[model samples]
Every structure is written in structure tokens, then in C-alpha cells.
Target: MKNYKLRRLSDQPILKTSDVKPSVDGFEVLGAFNPAACLVGDEVILLLRVAEAPRGKEGFILVPLIEEQNGTPELAIKEFNEPAAPYDPRVVTLNGKVYLTSLSHLRIARSRDGIQFTIDENPFLFPARMDESFGIEDARITFLEGKYWITYTAVSEHGPGVGLAITTDFKTVERIGMILPPPNKDVALFPQRINDKYMLLHRPMVSDIGKPSIWLAESEDGVHWGNHRFLFGGRGLADNPFAWEGAKIGAGPEPILTDEGWLLCYHGADPTHSYSLALALLDKNDPAKVLDRSDAPMLTPELLWEREGFFPNVVFSNGWIQWPDGRIWVYYGAADSGVGVAELVRE
Candidate 1:
């Protein structure tokens, strides 16, 4: 991190596998990662994605699957032999179908100092609607219209899509269901209305056969997304790319409105699956217009905790709180094993 300060890191993971309850009754907690963050008054609230699955046997790993019986979806457990399963610990492939090894749910964690956190033992969002039958993943929050609107990745057997929810008090939430259809995720709304319309930063897989890349879409009413435009493109087939962002890219913490423009921090993955943090600047009036983009990553997997864990070689930001002192507090997931914090100040 050349331009930022490594302010405070939690004594341990602010939240970890041990902190979350399994999504299914008989399952086990595998990891707690990629929290959606926002500051509520003096408290910082994080909607954490907790991954859980049934315990596996000696020669096989148990895969969680969603099945329908009598018009109702239920959790089904299946085992894929270690030698037959073609995936890292996170994703798995059986036959010709790709399946996530565990199901996920969104749980809340609150903190005052930004380093120490008290995570809710119960989930803030579970897989209820058919749209989120598999579960809910990373969420980004936007405070607008006097309420907190949450845009999250809703996963199911069909595919990963975007889901919305709103809350006045963190105690109760109203789910708006699927806003953007399947094959889209990593979505966050601009904190304020832009040019009298709502602008959102999202990463939709370019095509059925393409990799994930950042995109911008607008809405008159926040629910119906239209006017799709590609905002940022990652490396192409024959192009040389930055080592930290050559393979894929996605929207990260909610956009920060700076005097220069809208400061956006995002995550990019290299072909080796190394995930790093980067930033970009967009025109305030027209966010679809990119002003300046980072040539190199701001942060990479450096520390031992960042380089080793459930999924190694990753330092990904989920949410951030900008202090009035001109310092930005970033809460990120390290190797999907725990959470860490970083600070960015005027350079």
C-alpha cells in the first residue's frame, strides 16, 4: 500500500468461521467473508457473507446443493470425491455443472472503533425467497432517500444475481427481491442521485462466455435497471495486463464522492486468482464517463494472513467509512479467513 496507511488490524479476524451460525441445521461453518459495510450513527455495521456446508468424509468433500420437492426448495447434501472434484476449496465442479461447495447467508457485525466488532450470531439475511435459495453474498449499502438501500449478490442454483433490500432501522429490513437478473453481481448504488437519476456501479459477466468486468447502469426508480453501459474493461485475449487485474474485475466499496470526481475502489483478480484492490475516478455528473483509472493496485496480498487462509492470495475490500479527518477506514477480507482494516489519506 504505497499511498495508504496500515492503520489498525483486528487482533484476530473481526469475524471468522467460529462467529457465524451454519445456514443449514446440520452444516458446519467454513468461512465468513466479504462483508457489506456502512456506518450507522457511531456504529459501523457490516453484513457478512458466511459460507457453510455439511461436514465432509475422508476422501470426499460434501457439496451443498439446492433441490425442489413439492414446490419447495430445500438444502441437499452431495459428496464429490477428492480426486473427482475439480475446484479449489471454494468452487467445485461435478460432471459438467459448476456448484459452490457451501451455501452463504448475510449476518451483521457492529463496531464503534472500526477494529473491534460484535457480530450478530444470527443472520441478518438468510435464504428465504426463491431468488436467494442458495444464499446471499457480499452486499454494498447506499444511504439515500432517508433510508439505507442494500445491493447484494443473491446466489441460487440457476446463477448469481443482484438483490435489493431497504431498512430504516437495522432491526427490520424490507427485501426488494431480484433487481438485476442472473449473471450479474458486485453492485453498489451511488450514495446520492446523479443528474436526477440513480446511477449504479455493477460488474456483470460480459457475456455467457466472458469474464466479469465493471459496468454502469441507470434507473429512474432504482428497481428497474436500464441503459446498460460498459464502464471499465479488463484485459483481453491477446493483451498484456497489470498483474493484479488481468483476469477479472468487480465493484468494491461504495463509491466515495470526492471534489475531483466520484472516487471508486474496486477489486481485480489476476489469472492466478490473486485478488487486489484498485481505484478509479469517474465524472460526477456522468459516472459512466471514466475520468482516471489506477495503473497499478493500491493493495495486494502481502501480510502472511493475507497470503494464507481459506483462499490464498487475496486482499479484498467489502466496505469503508471515511472519517471527517480526511482519512478513509476500509474493512477488507483477507484470504477469506478474516477481516482487516486500512486507511487512505490525501497523498
Candidate 2:
């Protein structure tokens, strides 16, 4: 980790909580983080996850929910006391039904240096489909065959599903609708196809019996996916506190294609929700076959930006960029409050 000079960019957080209410979603934006990074022409594009909550009575935690009423999706609010709400700040559950505490949308931010950014005033992608009634969260962007493809988390009453959008020029976007059924998120697509097939890394949240593990799926045309198989499992206890990734694990930025194999950086957490990142390699030809896995974390929550925020002890991302000289730039959302960048130099 020493050779990889991981410094917090001076511009620190390139995006933040917005006061503006979503045009048609929620009351006001609370936080923005977990950006999806990639390059477009000379500009570094960031699709930020902007989280918003309804402005309801302060004492009663208002859980905003959506229901398909009269053939149309409608927003509904459920008031609850602090103790009755779900233990997780991000979600609420009642009678075995789960709902999001906040609604999320994707806003655009761009920069040339990747440190200094210019964020768009309004969100570009919000809850448009019934599947995304709760809102859209973390997104993964891949530049495939001359177009930028976006696979993002579409959260709602049923569960979290994966949705697709494509754009040739950032100005126009084509929505492809929900691709994954439900109970899934944390998706990444390889920039180049494997064996002439579009390969994907995705995480599907499980019930009591399962751990948040990584899985692989293949598609012929970058849309339809099948032939699901297990890829990697999350860590838990180890001799050192920094070694365990037990809480849950998910795919981070899209995998980097290196001469060795497909280099994937993924996040793992402890039971306390302390998030850290690790590395893995997948066979270039058959991504389902894991070539190597990290015994220790490449990066963890150490700095204040990473250790504190709305969601403390978190450093999560959906994107990263590698330069020609083998220098890697990983931009992540710290504590779900703001954004930060880390640099990695290949030894």
C-alpha cells in the first residue's frame, strides 16, 4: 500500500448534498456519493448517487414508499417512531416488507483533471419506471463498442433490481428498462467483451441464509443475462482486524483489463459495517474462474473522510480509471456524504 500513494484529493468532495428537491421524487437532496466514473472524450464523467428524503415531521421518521395504484406509480409516506423504523438508516421494514428511508437519483459531474469537478445542477436520471419508484442509487458505467452503458440500482418495494441506460453523446440517453429481476445491485460490466460475449459482475442481496457474494453472468448483446455462477464470497473473521471482509462484499469499479488477467477491486465490510477494499483476478477467457484473490485489503477506511459521514466507516465506489502508464485512479464515495479519490501505482 505504500507504493500506491493514496492521498485525498485537495478538492476533497467534488459533489455534495443538494438543497434542491427532486423535480418529481422527494423533498430535498440529503447526500451524494458512490459515483460511477469513466472517460468521455477528454472529460472525466461522474454519475453521482444523489440521495433525498421527504421533509416530513421531524419527530416521526417518515419512510417514503411507492405503490402501483390505478395503473400508475404513486409515492406514499409511512410515519414511524425511531425505535420502530428499520435499524439501517437507509431502509425501513414493516411486517416483512422493506422500504427505503431515502430516495436516490443520479446527477452528472464532469472534470478534466478528475479532481476538480463541475456537477450538473439537476439530476439526469431519476425514478421514471415503476421498478425505480424508490429511486436509483449506485451506478456502474462501461464504455463498450462506442457507447457508454449504465447499469444502476433500481430500488423499490419489491427489491433492488438492475436497470440499463445507453448514451452515445451524454446529451441523449436511451433507457433499456430493468434487466435484473430483484434483490440485486452492485453491478459492473467489462469494457471489452470476453469470448465475444458481454460479461457482468453483480451482487444480489440475500435473505438470512446467504451472504452478499459476487456472481458472474453472461450476455450475448450486453442486455439479456443468464448462466449465473458464483464468483467470490465476502470475508468475515481473521487474525488481524483489517483482514476480515465478513459483513458483506460487492463489486466496486468496473474491472480493469490488465496483461495478467481481469483485475477487479471489490469492497468488503465487517459486522460493524466497516468497509474496506480488496483485489481479485478473473480468467480473461472465463471470468467465472477466479485466478487470484487478495488475502489482505488494498485500501480501507482510515482517513476522516472515509471514517465519518452520514454512514460512517465506509469507502465505496462504482468506478475507476487507469491511465496509459499503469497508474490507476479510484474515485469513491466516503461515508455516503461526499466523494474522494485514491491513486494506485502498479509495482
Candidate 3:
């Protein structure tokens, strides 16, 4: 087995503890910034998942909204504590009063140095209808042809699904609507066309029939997709319980094509529910065929911030930028609170 080492690119949280704490309206838990980098003029832009909740309380499920408090836009939390409601682990129960957590929308933040980021004054995206009332999360950006392609998680009462939007400039987005329907998310589009067809990674949740596993889909026009097939599932000496992901594992960023194969960084959660970052290499021509995969994580919750926060023992990445000099800059959410970056040598 070949050993791969990942190094911290930035010593501190790149997007937290600001001298000026920018108002994210009703957002509280912010994470899963995808593509992590885009070229805008001479600068690189990042679109972050800003999870919002109301003030002074917590629960499992509720809708988030931007409410003005003391002339400042703050994330408002609402609790849904109905006994008939679905099960959620994040909420607490007390005195037959079921309290739910509120989640609302996504915000944008940009950086010049790819370290220090400035939150936009306004939201980049939000859930405007009943279908997406639960908000959006974990966006993946793929710049292809002449447009930036974005695939994100659209949560609602129906279930979690994947949504698509495109942008020529990061400021304005043209929503392509829900590309993949219910119980499916974590969609990542390849950076370029494969054999002149678009390729994507998606997870279709089959609760009763099967476990959540990574699947491959192809599209000729990048909108309409077909040819769905299982790419990989939870399997190894390390894999136990033999159930969908043991916890969960999915595509990280757009695969980096190298002479060896397609280098893929993925996130895997153990039975303990602790999240870690792992690596895999797939055949270049047939990406669905797995060539090799790391049994353990290449990056885990080793840092103080990563080990402790809103959720501990989590280091998740959706975006990584490869420099011409061969350094890979990976921007990831740490402990579900803020964003962090790391560097790995491309061997």
C-alpha cells in the first residue's frame, strides 16, 4: 500500500473569527462549499452553504428565515415538535413538546487569497417554495465549456433531492430546476466532458431496498441524464455491518485525472458516525471501475477545531483547486462550523 500524506494549508480557520462578523441573515451552521474555487476576473470565488436557524433555541426540524433583529438580519429558528413528525437525531424532546431545528438557505463568500473570505451582503441562493422549504446544502461547482455548473442538495418535506443552477458570472445564477428527484443528492459533475458526454456522481437513497451508495450517470447535454450504474459501495476488511456505507461515503470533488488514474477524494463516516476523508483512484476511461481505494482516511479530525465544534470529528471537502505548480488546495468544512483548507502533494 502506498502512503499519502495531507498537510494543512492554512493554520487557522479561513472563513471564521472575522474582525467583522458579516451578517448571514438567518444562517447559523455554514459548510460544504463546493468546487471551492472559481475564476472571476483575477480573483477566485467560493459559494458556501450557510445553514440558518432562529435565535435562542434549537430543535430537529423547522424552517429558517431572514428576520431583522435590532436592524441586523439574523437567522431565525423555528421548532416543529409534533409527535407525528419524522425522526431526526439533532432535535431534543421535552414534556411532550417536540422541538425541531430550523434550516433555511445558502450564502456566498469570496476570497482573493483563497484563505481570508468575505461574506456577501446578500444571499447567493435560498429556498423559495414548499418543495425546497428545508434549504440547500453541499454544493458542487464544475466550470465547463463557458459556464459554471452547480449541483446542490435541495431539502424539503418531500425528501432531499439534487438541484442544478448555472452561472457565467458568480453574481447571477440561472436555475435549471431540480435535475434529480427525491431521496437523491451529493451530485458532482465532472470538470469537462467525458467522450463528449457529461458525467456525474450521485447518491440515490434506497432505504428499504438497499444502502446509500455512489452511482454514475451520463448526460449528453448536461441536463438530461441516463445510463445510471453503481460505481462503488461500502466494502473492505474495514467495512462492517455490510449496510449502505456503514454510515456514508460519496464523491468529494471533480476527479483529478492523472497518469496513474482518476484521483478521487471522498468522505466516509464510520459506524461511530465520525467523518473522515479518504482517497480512491478509478480507471481513466471507465471511471465507474474502481482501481484502488484507501482503507483508512487520508485526512481526519486531528486538529482541535476539526475535533470539536457543532459536530466533532468531521473534516468534509467539496472543492479543491489544483495549481499549475502541482500543489492541491483543498477547502473543506470543519466540524460543520466554518471552512478550512489543506494541501496535498500529487504523487
**For each candidate, what TM-score against the reference?**
0.90, 0.89, 0.83
Best by TM-score: 1
RMSD of 2: 2.8
Tens-digit lDDT track of model 3 for 251-277:
887788888878888887767667777
Residue 294 displacement in candidate 2 (angstroms): 2.1
The window of 10 residues in a row where model 3 has the poorest summed lDDT is 17-26
RMSD of 3: 5.2
Q: What lDDT score is found at residue 189 in candidate 3?
A: 89
Per-residue lDDT of 168 in model 3: 89
Q: State how far residue 313 of model 1 sits from its true place (Å).
A: 0.3
Task: Kindly list the per-residue Cα lDDT of model 1 for residues 195-238, writing each as its tens digit.
Answer: 88988988886666767889999899999989999898775332
Tens-digit per-residue lDDT, 212-312, candidate 2 = 89999999988899989989897566555544587789998888887778888888988788887777888887888898877777777787767878899
Model 1 ranges off by over 4 Å: 1-12, 21-24, 59-61, 79-87, 207-211, 235-241
Better of 1 and 2 by TM-score: 1
Better of 2 and 3 by TM-score: 2
